[model samples]
Target: SKLICGSYGTLAVIDEVTIKTLPRPETSLSLLFESDDMASAVALIAGIFASPHEPGAAAILPQPVAAAAGIDLAADFVVVIRLEGIALSVDDRAGHLRGMGGTGGTVETVPQALSETLWRRIRDVDLLADHAGDIWKLSCPPASAPQIIAAIEPHFDMAFYADWAGGLLWLAGPSGADFGTALRAALTLHGGGHAQLMCDRGKSKQLIPALQPLPPAQAGLSKRVKAAFDPLGVLNFGRMHDGI
Candidate 1:
């Protein structure tokens, strides 16, 4: 008679779903800025943080990732910012961002349809299609993100892009890289980065488990909740935990 909606639903019968929606902006647009230097790209993004632009979505993409998305950006890194609202306001903010890239920074805006598609590629790591490796989905502190990427750069050549303002990153580690040691360490350098295996390219056993083991406090709380809701461990087959 009851239903669980998320991953745990596999363990039970589900019937209903709910989706959230946000207010639409009168005019929607995206900005693409490029610089060979990672620091310049990072600095420009930092400047954007103080500017008036309220981006609907914003991300930093490496050259490889940019190419994979068909962005035609030659710079080492590209900073993408999306604005959705009144056309006049959007133009003002877009202009402000373009102006911020005064030296060694080039900026451009793609059509609305193309812009949405590019952002989706970064969001989904679409370019990693057909690749065989683990994809690391990371959530880290916004300003410290650049430092994290900088730290990880020397170890391996990875394709990555970040939804900068959202503090989210999608990175695909190179094959044969140490997922347990190198990947996790890089994700944690800026702060305690919580990672989960969003998708496994190989679909085989991996050094880093799909999900990290829960901490005792969290484990205890979850145990208590599960007991109260589905003590029989019948809701899902170890959907959220080993037992249930």
Candidate 2:
């Protein structure tokens, strides 16, 4: 399961799959907190995660991205925390989050309809869809996000946002910039993480790796596993990595 799940169709052919779906929450609410910058937004998200709220989802959207998602939070950035469950419980949790202070700016509560729209935009990358660039998905420690963003700021004109309480970053960098190298460097300096190229745009795959390179031992294991599953090297050869 581990080998085939993220194999990008390299390991085997999946003819049929089964998935279990959960019933929708009875109600949902999103708490929007205005933040002066990314650091403050991340801090706010961390506080929420530390509390007992058990947020359904959390994200930080820069003003431009928020606007793109039809969210008009007139601030530099907006930290969004969503709560879901029975209507009464959701309302109670939201009130607790509101009283837990240190928000630094205005706070607003969005109803279920708008909350669903906002999360859908975040989940579907609707905020980044109109941008003309290559898309990179970065995963790192939540606390290191601000530093990583700072490190990569000088390399390219980019737009980005954080989800999963700042642990996952979605970035859109100019097509010609060396995104993989720059992002990997930042991740290395701040904290180890992975960056995957989600969209090609105009960049050459030969020039940039679509997936992060594994360590020597892991790389060897990956090759062995690949050979075991597709010995002839015929199934999506080089689809995820070179010479796999």
Candidate 3:
């Protein structure tokens, strides 16, 4: 099940469970970078990417993601990078990433205990609602996350959490989501941003668009797409809008 989140552009890609589980000729390796500042955390990730050897996937966390579950983060910033395929090739690649970090950056295997907990925390947006108010998920490219988050803070006073590089952001609105064009304008001016109307307490039905830029073509396509996936629309019918 491909989770599409855009009307005109690709907002995010949440791979289906089966697609994620498909056997691949690859393996994933996790590298953690510790720092207190977000700049340092991002710097480390960028450095790893700049390396001649680029890994499969990389994640940066200002704090230990494990703490979101229960564990505490001793470091102010913890970045995780994963390399996949051919275990024998991993050593050199891992070494290349570590070398790029200079000193004090600990490159180690992501412990199973912590890895599983963080994975669940990132994928499970439902848990975020418990921490704050009306929750929203924003999916953009990794590099664009920080700037977008800053622009959003002024419009709505809320707590923020991010995943999948900076690409995915989760925030909870202190007030109900009265998201006007102001929110939309900020993102458009500064690159890209999209908001999903998560939970609204006041309305009988959801009041925001699930996907952005609801052009006529996309609006029609979304309906047909939904009908294909869920002919009954039993999932969250009318939650995005009247027609969906």
Candidate 4:
């Protein structure tokens, strides 16, 4: 089950599946911290995670991405932290989070309806819907994100935002750039992470891999697992990787 879950249907075919859904929180609130730079915005997110407020979701949206999502904040970057649960608990946490006071930015409380709408757009990557290029999803240690972004910025014409308190980055780069290579290089230089090409609208799709290459030991293990599941190598062959 563990091996088949994220295998992109390269393993066994499932006949049926069941998923358990949780009850939605009774109420939610979001705190928005407007910062002038990525570093400061990320730092504010870090501070929120360190506190006992326990945010349900946290993300950093740069000015362009925010504007694209219809967030009309007059700031360079916005750090959004959401708290959810019973009405009283959510309100309490939001109050504490607001008192924490971000560095070099004004903080605003977003109403519940607007908060839901904003996070939905972020989760769906709707802000980049019109981007006519390659989109990449990256995950690394939260603290290393600023450096990774800095490393990649000079090379590509791109737009990006961070979620999971800056641990996950969603980036859209020009169609023809060697974005996969450049992004992996930046990840290696800063800290090891995973990169996956989510959308491709140009020739680079044939030139670059959609997923990062696995390390030697991990690659061997994956090959062995694949053989166990599909001995004839016929099930979704090469869907995830070149040979296996």
Candidate 5:
């Protein structure tokens, strides 16, 4: 290749397969918030973010996740929420969520077999390893991801694979997704860090600009000089969503 520039989640996921067993592993717990209306559920969890003394992982689906798995969505919405840590912590959180709505949805520990499947889906990047597309990494407080997911998930038709334990999300949407708007909304609700998008397609270029921590005056001077060099604005304007 003539050039290469991008962020790769895992250059490699596994060298070989191996397994180990624990004599007595700690228990893992999870909850399913079933609702015909997902919008309401989204608000409930968003409320939790307001006070995150102990938040494990929360994901709200505007539509059923079955569509992502190739099955048509049958319900209006379904939210999959998980809380894990020490056994006592997880148990307390689970009890809280259950008390939110009348108990109907199933509550079960993520089975060992299912855990391996989710891990492989997230850890393995072989399928997308070769594509040339800009990869955007959005960073927000861990608790805010669910609300952010809820806000944008309803608008776009795309694929999303989330790694909540690591507070990582990978979303592939249409070419012109409103990343700036989405980021702002998420930041407002959850309150956290900035985001980075690495261009992986169309000549392996860098799309969004790298963030800096310099004083505002120096940053402004640098921006002015760059604009002076290309006063006609010939470069891909606003690709970084910053108005020059």
Candidate 6:
């Protein structure tokens, strides 16, 4: 929790980090499950996280995105669950997950190389990096995710995927979408949460704020902390918000 990650150098410039390299698990397996039921798909994933077979990594990608990632599953949604540990333990946990569906769902093993490729896509978290559109990353509770997505769907047509077991949603929409109003309102309704505009390719660079506007109180505290580190405000100044 003390470590800073995923922030694009706006927090602190890490010259080096002494990280503990975990011993490689003797057996690592990636499991892929496909189904039309988004609710059940997410529920199964939730169950996995709450179970003894806690997954090392997990994600949910829609059919189109799954196809893009070369994951072939004959269903509308694909839940990717990865298990890694002792060989026998991994297999036993996987069997438990498979048995969760009985004859109702399709559970399959994903090849190692292919699994790596798909996870990389999820990690990059830039579904529309090249497009002249507004890209947003949202973080909220997993249970409230489907409702949030449901609300955002009618307002702006966007493609999305979930990571961290649906706690984070990477969504993209056309440029000039109402993030300040409609989109932000939807987020507030579900649960007051964080939403950052990753990029706005179509907007003028001079006008667009580097990140979405933070609440006034948080904005002030952010500036104070940044000043403690970079008093001159030299490192990526204005990249997060004005005057910081």
Candidate number of the best TM-score: 4
lDDT of 2: 0.87
Predicted candidate 3 versus true structure: per-residue lDDT over 14-60, tens digit per residue: 44534336566345556676666555666666777777776655555
Minimal lDDT window, size 10, model 1: 1-10
Q: Judge candidate 1 at residue 182 and give its lDDT.
A: 61
lDDT of 6 by residue, 9-68 (tens): 666777766878988778777898876756666787887788887688888888877777
Answer with 3 or 6, whichever has the higher lDDT: 6
For 10-77, candidate 1 gives per-residue lDDT tens digits of 34554675678988677778888886766566677777777767767778877877777787878888
lDDT of 6: 0.73
Candidate 6 segments whose C-alpha is farther than 4 A from its true place: 1-16, 126-132, 179-181, 204-210
- Relative to the true structure, how large is the alpha-carbon lDDT of every model? 0.70, 0.87, 0.59, 0.86, 0.48, 0.73
- Deviation in angstroms for 189 in model 4? 0.6
* Per-structure clash totals for the candidates: 0, 0, 5, 0, 2, 0
Instruction: Tell me the lDDT of model 1 at 184.
Output: 62
Give the least accurate 10-residue stretch of model 4, judged by summed lDDT: 98-107
What is the lDDT, from 0 to 100, of the residue 152 in candidate 5?
A: 74
TM-score of each: 0.83, 0.94, 0.65, 0.95, 0.47, 0.84
The Cα RMSD of model 6 versus the native structure comes to 3.0
Error of 5 at 215 (Å): 8.6
Ranking of predictions according to lDDT: 2, 4, 6, 1, 3, 5
**Model 3: residues >4 Å from true position, as ranges?**
1-21, 24-29, 35-40, 50-54, 64-66, 69-75, 102-108, 126-129, 154-157, 179-183, 199-207, 213-244
Task: For residues 121-235, write the lDDT of model 4, one tens digit per residue.
Answer: 8898888787777889999988889899999888878899999899999999987547788899999998789999898878676887788989888888889989998999989
Model 5 poorest ten-residue lDDT run: 1-10
| Best of the two (3, 4) by TM-score | 4
Candidate ranking (TM-score, best to worst)? 4, 2, 6, 1, 3, 5
lDDT of 4: 0.86
